[model samples]
Target: MAATESLPVTGGRRLYVQLGITLVVLVAAGGMLAAHRATLDSGTDRLAAADGEWLLLACLAAVATWVCAAVAQQGAVAERLPAGRLVAAQFAACAANHLLPAGAGATVVNLRFLTRCGLSVRRSATALAVKAAVGGVVRCVLGVALLLASPGTVRLPARVPPALLVLVPVAVAAVVLAVALSARLRRAVGRGFADVREVHRSRARACALWGGSVAFALLHAGVVVAVVHALGLGLPTGRVVMAYLVASGAAALLPTPGGLGSLDAVLALALTAAGAPGPEAVSAVLGYRLLTGWLPMAPGLLVLALLSRRSAL
Candidate 1:
């Protein structure tokens, strides 16, 4: 009886710890949101009159992107487990990402999920790294193509010129050189290439991954546009896209939790440079955060809750 009572107490203590950690993260994220919110007009009357259809579409697009992301994750882990299981693992990982400090928490959660599903830690780590690399490469390529194709749409500040174009090719060359220089990466690339060859697979998977990534990128950009539309702000689509890509790319490179403060700052600056009034741009960015960062977090938190309950049972 004492042991039974102690078990409940122990579990309760653990639950409290988890709740405390989650609350801390929420508080930190809220603080960042509040700081940005201060710069926004965020008038209740304006927010109330915002368009609904676009907001709904934005939510749909975000969900679609999440699904595509899960599919891509599954593809990367296909060799380790059934596709359905891998998809579930991906969703769980995404949920963890929302709750944890850095996005890396999602990767750790994913590795655990994969291990539970019978994959070795080493294999799971390798697969996750590959998936992340593929996703990042695809997004970067699409971002560059979009920026180049619609140069007029994506205006940089006067300080930034077309000469910045050199950075893209330079980045590509650097990556190729790095791959050649690193024996580990070279061997991995060689093995990956050989795997495709032996499986009679060409670049089909790569193409599909890139296509899906681009779709997600566009969908993410649409979220910002929808937010602006919802706020009744007449922002240019191209400018919005440019800001979204730049802010997103910078956030991806940052070590902060989900890029917290840095993303909002860059976005606000980008929008301002593109001729959006400061208050309006900040308002639009806040709305974008609500849709992209917070709304999904509710579902993610619920998923985490269910997982915890199952573990307790």
Candidate 2:
């Protein structure tokens, strides 16, 4: 009787947490609209002067991230999922991702959606772990390959800024410290090894998993590169992508919602270190965020709310 009684309490707490995150997401979207440029931290002013065509390209690439995410989600599990609902869930999950630090919102939304798709809770959790681990591996591989293929492409700035020097060591140390201290994280790693074996049992599923993760990372990198071009900055595409990969990877270590402030800070410094003008580097970061985060948020929110109402997620 006691064990059963505690179940409701645990579930109720989870429900409350989900509701709180959803509320925060909705409020953020509304706030962005209401405050416009001021709320967005001056990105809008810079974007207004950029080339319209390139901006549109960035927006389109942002939209494609949903498709890639859905594909990867399917690959994470052996069982097939409903295509439409899967896409919609990815959309909504990304919107929620912006509100919670370290992608907690996105993970919750995906986990709930997988459960709704007739998966056992443990199996659904395993699938999530598989996807996360695969995604990380794919990102690192791509970053390394790009660097090896284009040696000397990433030129240093005339002088390394203090911000770059400070941020780099701090981010690396933070990640190392977090890994060393967390027993739970160690447990998760053990589970993730099980995840890899399960996900690779089917060749097709492995392809989808790897392919989707690759496209997802590349598409996001493309958005950043396009933004640089749109701003009329002459930074090489290779350096722009490298900067994004490094900054985003570092920012991922910190628990900031969608890498909001952390990503912005690190990205600007990274771009500066890559020799972009300070103002243009800032504008490039802002432009990419607007395209990827702000622009698609409303539709994502709507999809999320509807999925919630229908118990689809």
Candidate 3:
């Protein structure tokens, strides 16, 4: 009942978010044309001259992210949602993420979708939280796995810094102490543990949650790899993936919508650090954003608006 009641509110918010993004795009487009015309033209020419086959792979990988998102969302709960709508919702959510900060857009669209599909409000929110928690863990694990599987892929210090080693345990202890002392946080942690345990009870659900999340992260990184190859950038793929994971994690600290400017800047720096030339690194970042960010907007907007048209039950 609470879920049903909250649908209209979230749905309305999502509409506003999309509309706001449309306006920003229009304004940003004009600004870019006027302010960065030369750069735009350069990027356009570069994109035009890029390898078609690699670009196509990037596009496909970008689309595959939506499917993975849907799978993870489904795995977050025991209920079976309609596959088609789930994908559409994820598409719309991803689109919204580009406009709103801290995942506000995704929260709106997905929560509404879950409620519209009959999940209770609390369960819907919990599912989102659970998926997020699992996604973070999976990203770290994947990065470590890649490092171990591929020898000398990324350079790490042969020994941990003495000061850093001491600080790490202190930080962990501080966090645990805070959580243990805060009743609100304690309840939140309890709820998260309970939901995670429930998800683990179903073998398929656990696999989908972890596997889908890992695939989603890899596919997103694959876009960067494809774009690099498309532009004949000679950086190693393993290094690019590791750089992307690090840059993306850093970008999350900033509240930029879909990580627009923040991600571009950080990722470009990461690529450069990974041995890509500065200009080429920026170009690769532009190509990555073009595929992952801009390309999905049109379809996502249409899907969001269509979802908004339905009445709250």
Q: Where does candidate 1 clash, by residue pair? A: none
Kindly list the per-residue Cα lDDT of model 1 for residues 3-35, writing each as its tens digit: 988998999998898778667755754665456
Candidate 2, residue 289: Cα displacement in angstroms equals 0.7
Give the Cα-based TM-score of candidate 2 against the true structure: 0.82
Report the Cα lDDT for candidate 2: 0.86
Per-residue lDDT, model 3, residue 198, is 96
Steric overlap count per candidate: 0, 0, 0
TM-score for each predicted model, relative to the true structure: 0.73, 0.82, 0.86
Off by over 4 Å in 1: 1-45, 80-92, 99-102, 156-204, 308-313
User: What is the lDDT ranking, best to worst?
Assistant: 2, 3, 1
Residue 133 displacement in candidate 3 (angstroms) = 1.3
- Per-residue CA lDDT of candidate 2, range 99-179, in tens? 778999899999999999999888899898788878888889988898789978665468999999999999999977887
lDDT accuracy of residue 268 in candidate 1: 83
Regions of model 2 farther than 4 Å from truth? 1-24, 31-41, 155-191
TM-score of 3: 0.86
lDDT of 3 by residue, 56-139 (tens): 999999999999999999999999998988998999888778777877878878999999999999899999999988888888
User: Which sections of candidate 3 miss by over 4 Å?
Assistant: 1-39, 157-167
Cα lDDT listed for each candidate: 0.68, 0.86, 0.85
